[model samples]
Target: MQHDEFIIQVSNRAPLSSRDHAELATRATLETLAEPLAGGEPFNASAQLPRGIAEYLRHQYAESGERFSLDEFFGRISQREGVELPDAVHHARVVIEVLSEAISSGEINDICSQLPSGLEPLFEASSQGQIRVNT
Candidate 1:
């Protein structure tokens, strides 16, 4: 998907009001995902993502090599967004679900393969359609 399509899909799946808001949320989520997959073959996993999403992941390629678990990932997002943990989790789920739609299934599968087992629930949740957004 293109940047505009990505933003629209994310906005539709999330509570955010505009494309700018979706862009911010999407970038934050992709950056957080990069933290775990950095400095390895997995680091290049984002290459198969949509152009816009890939850009977000690429921006974090040179990050300080921070690593985090799924829980910590949500915590960092919460802190950065200044929202409660639950809200952050919800936002991350929405972003991930939208990403699943925006990218090829093989890419999503490759990403999941690179992550720890603990993070499986996030992808499973998205696949189960647990967070559908009203059109």
Candidate 2:
């Protein structure tokens, strides 16, 4: 999807008040998601995302993943997005749902493969939809 469409989806789905809010949520979630993905995985995922938004994933990559739990993942997103934990989690779910829609199924499947099982809930079919990472 194009960047504007991606942000619009995130904004509408999260029911956020503004485009800026949606952008922040997307950035936070993508950056945090990048933290746990080892090697060039984040770069691989970013390859399919829109240009500027993809940097959120690209900037977070390391030679190896910095292991953390699902809760910790949410914690980081909460901090980054400057929202409360519950909002962060919900926004994250929405961003992930959009991400799945933006990228190919094969790409998303590769992403899911890298995450721990606990984080799997983010990808599970939801009433809202599926997993997303970046714009």
Candidate 3:
């Protein structure tokens, strides 16, 4: 995702930020995942996540030295069965999940390659779930 596309995907879901911060956040999260592709390991499990979707999360982690946090927004929504998330996070999760699936399928470069073309459609299709970005 030539960095810019990753930033765009994040801004599509969250508040926009300066380009530098966006890039830093993207690199941080990707770096967190770039090693030892053993999926079942703890770091691997946590690293598989996409934390760069929200500028706030990135800024928070950068300034406060905390990694991505689900507790702040969703508060463990994925843990409790039948509990629903707020529309925004839900939609963001959809986008992230799709990206994750593509990554897992060894299509990271393929998906990233079609970034400009594929991104909007992926975001739009993810909107079909019970979620809305409101922006």
TM match of model 2 to true structure:
0.88
Mind giving the per-residue lDDT tens digits that candidate 3 earns over 1-135? 333565666555444355554443344333322221222232322344444433322332222222333333233323221234553344345344434542343344333332333132222223444322221
RMSD of 1: 4.2
Query: What TM-scores do the predictions have?
Result: 0.76, 0.88, 0.31
Tell me, by lDDT, which candidate is best.
2
* Model 2 misplaced regions, further than 4 Å: 60-63, 126-135
Question: Where is model 2 poorest over a 10-residue stretch in terms of lDDT?
Answer: 126-135
The stretch of ten residues in a row with the least summed lDDT in candidate 3 is 33-42
What's model 1's TM-score? 0.76
Ranking by lDDT: 2, 1, 3
| lDDT scores in order | 0.68, 0.82, 0.35
Predicted structure with the largest TM-score when compared to the true one: 2
What's the number of clashes in each of the models?
0, 5, 0
TM-score of 3: 0.31
The candidate 1 region of ten consecutive residues with least summed lDDT is 126-135
Ordered by TM-score, highest first, the candidates read 2, 1, 3
Q: How large an RMSD does model 2 have?
A: 3.4
